[model samples]
Each structure stands twice: as C-alpha cells, then as structure tokens.
Target: MTAFILVAGAHTGGWVWRQVAAGLRDSGARAYEVTLTGMDGGGGAAEPGVDLQTHIEELVRLIDRIEGQDVVLVGHCYGIHPVRGAADRRPGRISRIVHVDVGVPEDGDPALKLVPDQTDRERVLSLARENGAGTLPAPTVQEWQRWGSVAGLPDDALARLTEQAVPQPLPTLTQPLRLSGAVAEVPTTGVLCTANGSSIAVVEAMVGLGDPAFQALADPRVTFFELETGHWPMLSAPRELVNVLLRAAAGKGHRVAAVREQPTHLRPFLMDVEERPRERTGRVDLHLPDADGPRPAVVFVHGGPVPAGARPTPRDWPAFVGYAQYAANLGAVGVTVDHRLHELTAYGRAADDIAEAIELVRADPRVDGERVALWFVSAGGLLAADWLAAPPSWLRCVAASYPILAPLPGWGLAGGRFRPAAAVRGAGRLPIVLTRVGLERPEIAVTVEEFVSAAADCGAALEVIDVPLGHHGFETVDPTDASRDAVRRAVRSVLGHLRVGTD
Candidate 1:
C-alpha cells in the first residue's frame, strides 16, 4: 500500500487537508496530514522560533517512522520548502515528490523568492517585522484574496480559513532551502492549479525559454496534472485533489516533452511574405508602404511576460515581422512595439507601454492618425479590454490571434481590470476579428470561448476565423496552408475595417 504525507501551505495546518486526507484514506491509501512547526492544527497558540529546519526535521522523523511502505510526499505552496528539504535528506525513503501549485526552488533559495513580485515580498517582510515576534501575521479576511485566489471557496470555508489561520515564523521565509542534489534522482509530479495562475501550458512555455534552471522540469520522471481550481485545492476541491495525488503516485500523469532545439516563437512564420523597409523608433518599429502617402496603421501587440534579456525582442521575431511586412504590402503601415511585460503582474505597465506606442504610431507622418487598428497576439489579448470597453473614434477595429482574453484563475488581477470577455459587452460598433485555433491549450481556449459568447450575447461586431488544424502560436508552429490562409483572411478583415482602400 502507498503511504502519503500531506503538507499544507502558509498560515494553515493539517486541518486544511482534512477532506483530502479523508478522501485518500477512503481510497485505501494511508494519509498523514502534517501540522508543521509554528502552525496550529487546533485552537492553540503557535510555537515561537519554529523555523523551516524545525519543519524539515519533523517531516524527516515522520518518514523514518513509516517503515516497509512506499512513501509519496505532497507539498503545497509554502509547505514545499520543508517537503523538498526533507526529501533531499531522505531521497531513498521518498518514492515521489508531488508539488502542488508551487515552484521548484534550488539550493539556497528562500520561500520569499516564491512571491515573484519584489514589492509584495518587501511588504511581507515588513509585516513580519511589525509583529515584533519574528512571525508574519495571517492575512485578514479581506486580504486573503490577495494572498492566493479565494475563488471556488464557499463563504463558510473562507471564514473558517481566515479564523483558523496562524502566524507564520519569519525564519521559514528567510531561511534558504539546502539540497544535496539527492532528490534530483527521485520521480516528481507537479499539480498545477489552473485557476491560481498555473497550467501545463505555462510550464511548457517556461521550459521552452531555454532557461537551464527550468530544463530539469522537462525530465522524463517529471509529470504534471492540472486542477481547475485555486491554490487551496484541498479546500476548494478535495476529492479531485485526492484523485490526482493517487494518479501521481502511480507515475501516470501528463508528461512534458523535451524542449525543442528552437523555441516555437522563434520559428519561421507560416506565410512567406517579403520583408519591407522599416524604421526603428525606440521600442517601436514601423514598416511603411512604398505608396508614400499617409496610410492606415495596424499596430501589432505581441504577448508575454517575456524575459527582459530575450534576444531580438518581440518586435524582431519572424512572425511579428512577417505580419508587419504583410500589412505594409497591402497598402498599410505595419507597426510592432516591444513592451516591458517581464512579469505576469506587470500587465498594467504593459498596457501603459502599448498605449504610449499607439500614440507614437498615430503621430507618425506616414500614418493616418484617424485610421488605426490594434492587433493583439497571445497574452497581449487582455490589454485590449480598455479599448473594447471605451473605444476612441480613431480606433477602427481590434484583432486577436489565439489570445488570452480573460485572466486565468490565479493571476490575482483586479476584478475589473483587463477583463475583455466582460468588456466586450460595451464594444458597441467597434469591430473584433478573432483567429482561434483548434489545438490551443484548454486554459487559453476557455478564455477565447468566453469572449466569443459574450460578444454574441451583446450582438457585437465580431468575426471569428477558425483554424481547425492549428495550435497556439500557429503562425510559426503550425505552418500549414490553413494557418497561412487564416492569417491572410484576418489581415484583410482588419484592413477592411480600417477602410484602407475606400479612403
């Protein structure tokens, strides 16, 4: 029989895993819910000075006690630190390490590094200092949503979570996880919470970035399962979480393919259009038509939270260049601009960058300021929300290709921010041309479908060109005749809305 050790995240304890533990036990597996040091599983004050090392020792003791059985260690969020540290020390005792909606930290990495945003990390540290007890207080009921998504949780469950939360020891966040590289040989499973801002697609995209730190994630022993819930799956969907755990123990989950020699975005564009002469202006690149007269401009927006040091930036990518050149050949100005969306939380900054780029494009002497269209690609789709909600007279149309129209479940975006599916209701007469692919990732396809349904409900002027045989980044990845034809149709439709020849 397989034995499981479940560790809960920050501010919580074994109580949080009650339902999941019960479900696992019902399935004939032995489940052990651990209440880490510095946390309270019952109505009692937390122990002081309980650092990450304390938690690791506790887990190691538990693993040693469980003899003659295969052990699977499950870690969620902050719990991953101790679980990983313990696994590293007792690799032979651990059959598999299951990571739930958490990052894989390397040697000397702290839990604070998982926060991603520097400002947020600083705020957390500040809060810990304010306590004067070497502990960070639990988030208030209202603040819980900011810590991790509260989606799918009932009001009572949320209330219980808030009331039962315990202060986290500061050392747990500051102490670096020490590893001996022994755990690297152990099989691993990643349970991605799609609603909480993680998915298999996101993992694949990161691996494709050629970052050596993430290369290990593409290993054959590392598999993945996606849960369509928030960070606290044990609370929001216990039964489902239990099932995934069981499957993960059997080494039966989706396997991520090895990264290709060339990344998908860097591949050649499907259409073989000739390059046009372009002028560079800061981050913006302008491809002007030979006709010389002021022409309608199509500003192409590339999607990302791309790395700042990525070579040849988005504007210089072959697909963006091809799209720009194709538009220029059709008697229009093709514009591509690079923005600083280096982190998922930087969408606001990205939106501002795009707005600034548009103003610069409109002010260009070779472009007609009154006739402009915005073509958004990939994750850049959310940036169109503001324009769709309140379009300017000069904005002729909007276009998106395999775009993420709604914020994924755990992105923690403001409720009213960058929600194109909801904003499409107010689009009025502004035209929208969406190019969707059949093989798109489920998480992204859901957003596109949501936007389409909303547009239909509002009777908005929306046109969808389906590429049944294509995939995400189809312009480069699925270079079939269908992909090429869809791209051509989309360009013509956007230009038609711009009234390029009619003017």
Candidate 2:
C-alpha cells in the first residue's frame, strides 16, 4: 500500500482533506492529512513567527513518522509551497507529486509573484502590508465564496469551512521558495478546476500568448487533468477528484506530448484537433453537436505574432477549446485554428491562414458551409481586416473582440499600409458586432475609434458592444460578473445574427 499525504492551502487545515482521505482509505491506501504548525493551532505556532521554513519542517517530520519509502505528496493552493519545499529536502523518499487546483513551484518564486494579473497582485500586496504584523487575515466565508471557491457546496459544508478558516501568516506568501535541481526529477500531475471558468485550458491559452504565470504547464514532466468544480474540489467534487488521484498514484496518467483526453463534461460535444509535427503550417480544433446534420459554424482566430523565443504547440492553448466548446453548446459547430506568425508579413500570413481555415470548414460535410461566421480576437483581428473587407457570400456575420482595428506607431512594416477604412468600402454586407474594452490602453481605443468611424461612414452593418471598465484581455484578466455578462452577450448576438441554433 502507498502512503498519500495531503497538504491544505492557506487558512485551512487537515480537516479540509477529511473526505478525500476517507475516499483514499476505501481504495486501500494509507492517507495522512497534514495541518501545518501555525494552522493546526499547536506549539505556540499561532504567534507571528511562522514562515515557509516552519511549514516545510512540519512535512519533513510527518514523512519520518510514517516511515514511508514511496509517498505520493498532494498539495492544494498555498499548500504547494511546503509540499514542494519538503520534496526538495527529501527527493529520494517521494514517488510522485499531485498539484491539485494549485500548480508546481519554480525555485525563487514568492507566492505573490505567481499571481498573473497586475491589479490582483497589487491588492494582495496592499492587504499584506496593511496588517501591522507580518500576517494577512483570511477572508470571511462570504468573501471566500465571492472569490470563487466551494461552488455548489451545502450550507453545512460552508459553515464548517468558515469555522475552520484562519488568517494566513504573511511571511509564507512573501518568502521565496528554495529548491534543488533534484526536485524536478520527480513526476508531477496538475489538476485544473473548471467551474470558476479559469480552467487549465484557459491558462494554457494565456500561455500561448506568453503569460508567465502558466508557463509551468509547458513542462514535459507534468500531466494535467480538469475537475469541473470551484477551487475547493475536495469539498465540491470529491468523487471525480478521488478517481483522478487514484489514477495518478498508480502512475497511469502521464501524457508527455499527446493531445489531452477530453474532460468527462466536454466529451459529449468536443473533438480535439488532430496533432501534427511542430513544423506543420496550420491547425484547427472542432466542436460539434450530437445531432450531426450540417450545422452553422463559427471560426475563431487568436491574437499573436508570437515573440522570438516564445513557441507554443498548436493544441496547447485552452481558449481555442473553451470558445469552441461554448459554440457547440449553443448548437453551432465551433472551430479554432492556428496561423503563421511571420514578422515581416504579420497580417498577410495570418489572413491567408484564416482564409484557408474557412475554406476547409466550408468543405466539411458536418458544417452548414453557407452559414459560417468569423470571430477575431486582439492582434488576430488586424490580420483579418481583408476577410472583413471582402467577405464571401457564405459569411453571414463577423465579431471582433478587443481587436486592433488599425495600425499604430511601431506596428510592423505592413501595419500602417493595410487600412480598415479603405477595406470597408468593398466589405461584404454582413452584420458586424464590434466589442471594445473601455479600460484598455489609450492608443488601442484611438485605433478602434478610427475604424468605427470608417465602417459607419461606409454604411456598413454594425452594432457596438462596449465593455465599460473591462481591460484589454478582460475575459482572462479578471472575469467579473459584469465582464462575463458583456462577453456572453456579444457571443450570443453574433450567433443569433448568423441564425445559428441554440438548442
């Protein structure tokens, strides 16, 4: 039998792992729940001196008491810090690490540095500083719920959580992690919770565009699985969570360079894009309905002429799958494709890829062919100007979200030359839904206004969706209720205009 040690996140204790341990024990494994020194309310640890070192030492002591040779160490959220620190200290005793909802750590990274968004990072830093002593108070139950955890949990569960949660020591968040190269040799698995909308797939999409917070998933040794719940999977999704853990512990879930197996929730609607060699020119993933007659299809183009050294695989980004899945749920065939990122001919190559992708989708027997729509996001919108200018007869609608409508200073050689104003004159007569971010950079707004003026003057069919207070990458930056509602409305409007089914 294998020994499984569970480590809890900040402000919580081993109590959170009780249900998981019960599930594990039923499967014939020894499960040990760890309560860090300060968090377990013992040995004067409640005082202000608890830091990263204190928690790491606690885990080391636990492993020794168990007298285990092959240990499967599991960590959730903030618990990753100590779990990883201890792994570094005793690499020979650990067999595999399961990073649930949280992620594997890189040496020298403090907790705050791992947070992706700037606004949220600053807010956390401010909160830590406000505590006169080196500690940040835990959120009340209401605050935690608002922050998107324990989705669909019962009242009793919520009450138990509230009673057990405590303020986390600030030094743990501020202290840098120290690791030896030996820790990287251990196999690792990452579980992404999808109910909050920031699934592993969503993070990978940001990584495709070079988001540093998600770069860890790109590691070859890490295999990822998605759990359809909030951040607290053990509380809300114990059955599914436990099954995944059992598979990981048995060494059955390692995907080195393969297409991800579809999550159980998405298997009914989605089909992965076939994987090809890294040098393959173009690729697209498809999402379809069960009925299987010719269905309306919406093609998605992501933003980027990726920088010099930031190379990502075609199927790596989750936004493509997420949007495609969203379309499938709405009764439309959803397609997300990749285009060439050429520096000299940035717009030219990506536009050509879009054209090629549309041709392919139109020829597919599963797609309605005549009722196809195009969705362009960010820089990909700039590449799609020509398609919007001279759209095909089958093109019924077009939606551009936080798009770069016109060229600006330092834009590539062809950027200033390709004009949206001139292109609108010959554009096909189609309903164009343009979504603008209110809190975006000043220069982006200026360019978008220029294109809006040109499209309106040319008598083009257009409807504007202004996401006030939404940032440039609002969907992923921070999906507030208002922002999500705005994006959903924009998607619905585009699909409705295309006459796509919503069953």
Name the candidate that leads on lDDT: 1
Candidate 1 vs. truth: CA RMSD?
3.6
Clashing pairs in 2: none
What are the TM-scores, per candidate, against the unseen true structure?
0.84, 0.54
Model 2: CA > 4 A from native? 41-46, 114-120, 127-133, 145-147, 198-221, 254-398, 401-503
Q: Which window of 10 residues has the lowest lDDT sum in candidate 1?
A: 40-49
lDDT for each candidate structure: 0.88, 0.71
Estimate, for each residue in 320-363, the C-alpha lDDT of model 1 and write its tens digit.
Answer: 99999999998899999999988777898999999999999999
Clashing pairs in 1: 195-409, 195-410, 196-410, 197-410
Under the 3 Å rule for N, CA and C atoms, how many clashes does model 2 have? 0
Cα lDDT of model 2 by residue, 49-125, tens digit = 67888899989888887775879899987889889999988888888899887656789877655443334456668
Q: What value of lDDT does candidate 2 attain over all alpha carbons?
A: 0.71
